[model samples]
Target: MIFLKLSYISQSRLTGLFSLVILWTLSTNTWAQKIIRAPYIQLAKSNSVLIRYRTDQATLSEISISTDGKTFNPSIKSTNKVSEHTVAVSSLQANTKYYYRIHINDQVALGDSSYFFKTAPTVGSKDKISIFSVGDMAAGETQRKIYNAYVNRQKSNYTNLFITMGDNIYCGGSDGCWQEDFFNPYHAGPLLRQTALFPSTGNHDYDNQAFPYQQDDSNMAYYQNFTLPSQGELGGIPSNSEAYYSYDYGNVHLVVLDSYAWGKDNFRIFDQENNIQLNWLKEDLKATKQDWKIIYFHFPVYTKGTYDSDVSGEIIKLRDYLTRVFDEYGVDLVMSGHSHVYERSRPLREQYGLSSEFSPEKNWPFNSSGRYDGSDKSCAYVFQNVEPKKKGTTYVVNGCGGQTAAHRFNWPHPVMEYSLDKRGGSMAIDIEDNRLDAKFIDEEGEVLDQFTIFKEVNKITKKTINAYDPIELKASWPGPANSYVWSSGEKSQKINLRPLKTSTYTVTDTQKCLQDSFEITVNPPLGTTKWEELIHQPFESLEIYDLLGRTWKSIQKEGFIDQSVMDGLPTGQYILEYRLKGKSYTLKLIH
Candidate 1:
């Protein structure tokens, strides 16, 4: 190639040299950056985030970060020339908002005040986190509506996190399908730039020509298109595989699993005793110490929506294998989306069988609507610290994020306390301390359903203390409750009492979200000190307890005890708990 002054070129030779110049001019267009796919955020952590984008041709990629939109730090540049670009920016403040921009070949391609993201809060931080999730949202107007609805509602409180329950793309999950159905809708201008996408795998994501569906686990478009917290960047055990992983946001531990059949192996997640995915999940669940544990995946363990959980193959297996693990670990929530509907269950446990075998009395140990709205025996599910590890788990089938209006027979499974299949919506979950609130926001921006769960709340206890002993009572439901009022008309978090006799006291929050009761019984000196005197007094109820705390005798009568009855008692140490003149008393007697 040669460039010479036009005037110096001879007329006969100008035509030959002109073709080279023309070719060079056309080749310059390739140098210009053509961003085919807009920038998206991913792999978010307390102090780092990953930004990924695609271009039409090879070009230099650079990213600039700033605390304010007007000012930016030195740009982070990658010299590698490639169509796909991933820039991981680290060494930042935790839970801090920052503006960013992408520069393709030294020109600003994406950046502004509106295009900013907030880093995840420090692990185990008390800061509140808002998460919005959708499932089976491939391509449709409904998907856009759901996205816009959440964005509109986020004006007052911005949430920078988003998750998907898979089937992210339609029609064989091709690269073009991903761009058209997924990347375009959440393109940089709308959501993807600000909100990090943490996605799970669905069968449709593995659908290749409908024949090789889920036949290639490592080669699926879903695995190729995104990078997640697979290396323990967010605080769980490093899975080293994208199939399943865990991430921590504030005090919440989010476990994303892959239940789809892996390539040609004809595998279920836990089909074998020593499966890699299952083993990773167990380690991840065991390793996370976050206050709230939530697991999300593609196939719902229990549902009677468009798909039947009772008869489905993988669904039944999920129920058989996963519930026991979740119960053993005290998993707070289990969310999935294969069925096309909205269904939520009461806190369930020991429920592993066909749908017809679902016994509410046996499965739902703490049964209630869990709406906390005072309608139809509605009460928040409580997780006591001393309760069994198999406390209860709330299973949610939120598959209708973009698809809806489908149902099977028995649309509302017996295990579910709330069910809705008329509209399409996504879930908005808010967590802070011991409380979690979730609402299903419909496409039209209406709240279709909502539920609340409280941990270590609404307690009742019985204590036996010596007379005039000081007993301190503390209210549960997280520290610094909205407002606390005790039965003694006190307005404090804790109260110390020195009662001469036994009495019952109760404390309730202003909103009545939680209540704690103390049934106090004042005990006399050891060894029948007051037994003789109390035997001649009238009492309402007398309870005789053995040294092992078992009730040996219970007499509910408004009469005095005779000496003959005391004499007839066997020789042993006993605890006498009797109410005399409306005041409870306890005495240790050796008969």
Candidate 2:
């Protein structure tokens, strides 16, 4: 009886445990089919939108979305697959916000099931966008912590997209690594529900069986992860195949390119032949009319980090060609990665040497400056004067995303405006009015660097004017000819003049810009002595002086020194005239 009782108890315990296991699985997978993952809504046209999402598990059943959660209305145009699906919600009003949800049913209509989404406004709308970017993200404790902190603090109402620059995983690539490096760090936060990640194929992400060994691998896990804009010119191939494309976000035009495709090993293998991307670039930039044009790729053209120009390399060649193209068109800013450091540059021209002065001539190519200098003296001063000198372009290397410190760079990296190698950082750019302010922010929310870029409304105004000379001309006598006063207010001496009618006379020289007037009334009375006549004359020759004042020439018609006299005198400063009546009189002249 005891043995039988023990057996019954053991059987009961095992049965109870099995029942709990089944219940747990059912609970987790209850709404898994209809409750999709990574539900993303992209703006299309006329309030119409495209919704892309991945299902929890495979399902061949037709899927649909409910405008109202209570109805089992299925969208007719939706393309459904076992793993992925896309549906278009259309015929809605422009700029109007609507709430809808996703639905998937296999056996019977699954009513009351959905995920919320909103359609985008019509073209030219003043829509606000919030985006995040990262590069060199690998699986690590601190990286994961920072990522979690960032997403937790972010607001989901307007956050639209996230960009992942290369080196997304470490140790080449593996499915397990991706799960740890990306999904794990993001799982704790609300990021997956709000923002969709757009990733470029990094070297590590390509080094796994998840993507085929072929260069034009159609089966990469990165491709399956996000849905990018699907309509643009890209190597004459479908947008999905060519990962390079352009998109409009509010007033900014963004261009994303694949820098790795230009490498020798990758170029021939991927068959990225004929420079199709370059032609597309020129055409795209020419046609774009946005307030700002920003481009991003995985390789930096300039950096003072682990990745330095080694004289002869593919990067140097790429820089030469790329800089010419970017400068030819007014590309406002270019961002890149692969250096495992963060850096910004001045409005750079050929780095070989600086221009004669501030230059707006964009045709000049960037020259090689070899290596960074040891001190930041010159660069620091230049940075101080770094105003909005013309339309400046900054090259940012944002590769210090999630990795160990690669290398330290000394100051004086050509075109380098700022550099930092510490990890756990990102940037925020705010576009307001015609000026764009970008702040480099670290994980702790500290501002590393802040700078502003201005839109060229009209070319800077230029003007020039002449200043007037301050010298004045005092006086001259009939008495003084070719007379002028120095700026010091001094007088000039007896100037030889052919006294015609000893009457008031005015002398002016516009070329020399001098003017003077003299009143000499010679009324020789018949009775009085000539000296008395001269003394009382309006031309009172009381005191006289030679040009240098070293000699004196006086003529009192009374003591009248009958003069063929005073013929020789050098030109200089002197004093003359007398107190006629009550006022003091004076004359100056250049002999």
Query: What's each prediction's TM-score?
Result: 0.75, 0.57
Q: Deviation in angstroms for 275 in model 1? A: 1.9
Candidate 2's C-alpha runs over 4 A off are 1-37, 40-49, 60-81, 90-100, 106-127, 152-157, 171-177, 209-216, 233-241, 262-274, 310-312, 350-389, 408-412, 456-591
**Deviating ranges (above 4 Å) for candidate 1:** 1-30, 209-218, 263-266, 458-507, 516-591
> What overall lDDT, based on C-alpha atoms, would model 1 receive against the true structure?
0.75
* TM-score for predicted model 2 compared with the true structure: 0.57
lDDT of 1 by residue, 1-591 (tens): 111111111111112121121110112235667778887877777777767777777776677878867777776466456666666666778888778878877888877677788888999997888888889885788888888888787775767578888777666778788888888987723568787788887878877744434533445567667777667767899876666778888889999888876523455685764667777788888888899999999899988898899888767887888998888788999889978889999889888888899887788877567777657667677788887742689999888878786689977899998788857888998887788988889899988778888887777888999854458987766535436889988878888876656789999876566799999998864556545665676788888776555667788887676675475567777777788777887777766
RMSD (Cα, Å) for all candidates, in order, is: 16.8, 25.7
Candidate 1 lDDT trough over 10 residues, lowest sum: 1-10
The sequence of per-residue lDDT tens digits that candidate 2 reaches over residues 145-166 is: 5565455445444444566667
